[model samples]
Target: MGNIYAGVDLGGTTVKLGLLTDEASLIRKWEIPTRKDDGGKQVIPDIAASIKKNMEEEGIRFSELAGAGLGVPGPIRQDGYLEVCVNIGPGMRDMNPVKDLSGLLGGIPVKGGNDANVAALGEMWQGGGKGYRDVVAVTLGTGVGGGVILDGHIVAGSKGMGGEIGHMVMDWDWKEAEVCNCGNRGCLEQIASATGIARHARIFMRESDRPSVLRDLQRVTARDVFDAAKAGDGLAEDVADYCMMYLARAMAYVSQVVDPEIFVIGGGVSRAGQYLLDLIKEHYDPLIKLTRGKAKLALARLGNDAGIYGAAKMVIDEREK
Candidate 1:
């Protein structure tokens, strides 16, 4: 029964809104499709409307909210401005999310951050790293995104551009990766992302003599590869193995660099379950030279609610400090 707070996770395709108590307890949550075609301009107004509707129907007062914590795809500038969002189109490049949304959201203070960082904070504060201080959270989706929690605080670099692990180089051989949407080439994102997994499977299907059950499906997905691997199909196994190896190598790489107490994996492809985690452990076990047994990888516990929880957490932690 404390002051209510709001957390919004804005993606290219959807916007997830959560209402929470100051204690991070979930009150009510909802999601709506994001209209990316109109550019970043449209999302703010839609969010404002949603908040207004919720106030009328749910009896939540806007003034009771301490602030709103927001998560958006792409790099965020320090003032909660959008620096780049490939999935949402180029219009977000110079968009000021805090300025726009605050105007629409009824003068509530807004703390903006990169989606991955928010998700990481979500996990750290109430999900996987609840009792821990140091952790690294990664989302394996259409593209890879990462967040680093160091010494109990979210690590936002000078301009809020910190903790972008997907851009880390995993393959020097690919040499100047294929120019990612972020304008970087040869990023681990091109290999470890969900889309990357599907892309890899597509190429394997074309060249490999290995037969796949996915051949008949209109589109082969990371899930299809997992299903195929379960069915004993070699092509599926190959794709799974390749993705796992890349993930494992990446985990090993992170272990060497961050040496966090845990590595939490979430996102669409993460549902692949043990097939993915086991592979990461398999590689992480042998290659990591930092310590004999200091780090462990765990699945993210919050699911989709982490963002809202993390958002509310921002207020609670800030007050404590």
Candidate 2:
């Protein structure tokens, strides 16, 4: 067997750890609860201990491993400093994850990046963006998160805010748009995210006399809207189209800047499948005059495993360097 590598996906509720070969094949995976008590100071130590326990159980030696990589839920600077991780706790703010994690793991090399970026790397390595060097990955979940991979490397930017495609303002007029969680008025997150899709459904139901199957449900989701549209509901189609148009517009703007070869859409909302992709493409094609219909769109294949795979890839790439 090749040298083993460790990947950690640190989340607010659980810490997912994976063991993979240098060739990126998954050997085993497990998870532990994230003990957030005492300001989350024990999180890193807990991870280190878990790695040690797993290594012993698997009869693996530290020297036989190729280091580790971490995917954190916040902005990570180029030097491995996490700006702020609200979900983990205030204690993790302004901390050097790579340094602290490596120290805990007996000086083994460690690398870290934003979770979304790491997920993108995973997709590029083994999922939807596989075989593509330059790619854009967007996860349209409760909120929109994205990562830009250029020349097979993550563009983490100076402040680690490089692929913040969600916060891009789509509507400047606050009067007609809802305020985003980021305190902005009409960010793409406000209309293109999963929650945003439901919000649009509510708004359309309130303003129009047209009835939708969505009105029958106590809670409407992005899935319901897409399903209703497939059933040929007029109001649902309108809501779906409106939500997708903003996302398409955002992609068009991103293309003008980075111009990636493909766009991989993931997250809970993306489960709408080919129908959603077609809707976005329908609106996206006309907006871009220069690179019309050049970028390919695909669904994410890795699902929850993407983060760990990306984290493992980070270690593999670092070892190569």
Candidate 3:
């Protein structure tokens, strides 16, 4: 009685798996180490093994499996191939992921998309973004990733590469380029990513001769900067403010295109909570098209599980559709 669906989030370090019931209730969840050296081959085998192991451990049968969805951290081609995933490895790029993974799963229908997009889908279907007609979700991890939903459906653009608000150029004159994996420069991602925040702190700490109350370390993290900002360190506050300014501009630009009613923020940096949200709202209003300032903001409730739920939604919807 194929009553269960599966969702897998393939990241650089780990693969998160979730077994969900027909009604979208999560049944079981676990993680597996990612084998980056084996390229895409290990991914499918690992995913298959995880699914089989979970079914056996939980006493479920293959006959009860419905479908599987995957959230892969890379630019997925319109036809469902992995075009590039710098976080993983080379050669896996431009590979037909959907075909390969489905084959590895014994022809089980497998659907795949960018990790961030699927994560947003997960939140919309089961987490904070639920019950909303239009929503945009951004996961503030090592780099910024985004997904857009319109009227209860995911919006994949003509190229199937939509919802890329992270690449929205906020400051054309800045000329500061970090070189994204996408081969672009001076992108908003370079400014608002977790790495950006930490880099900002490092730059500040270096230029000042005064000893920072923050423990002088070789490298400061985004969380450390947030803590310093909360503690009223002038340098940290300035850096955080810069991040807020860029984030606001990026959100405003996205709103102009997607016009989503709610913007749901997730990821490790988002844990900064109202402090971060408040700063974003402060600048978001001024940067937005005056006519489009009505969009609201919200925090993601699902945390890391969003990718799995989203992946499940992808497979289940395909099966039911």
For all candidates in order, the CA lDDT equals 0.78, 0.89, 0.81
Which of 1 and 3 is the better model by TM-score?
A: 3
User: TM-scores of the models, in the given order?
Assistant: 0.88, 0.96, 0.91
**Where does candidate 2 have its weakest 10-residue lDDT segment?**
173-182
State candidate 3's TM-score.
0.91
Q: Write the per-residue lDDT of candidate 3 for residues 187-257, one digit (tens) a residue.
A: 77777888878876776676676556555766788888888888898788888999878888788778877
lDDT tens digits by residue: candidate 2, 1-321? 237889899988999999998788898889989989987888999998998898888888767667899999899987799889989897788888888999988787788999999999999999999999999999999899999999999888999998999999987776455577678888988888999899989999999888778999999998899999989999999999998998999998889999999999999998999999999989988888874356889999998888899998988898888
TM-score, prediction 1: 0.88
The best candidate by TM-score is 2
Pairs in clash, predicted candidate 3: none
True lDDT of residue 62, candidate 1: 62
Q: Is candidate 1 or 2 superior in TM-score?
A: 2
What ordering of candidates by TM-score runs from best to worst? 2, 3, 1
- What TM-score does structure 2 among the candidates reach? 0.96
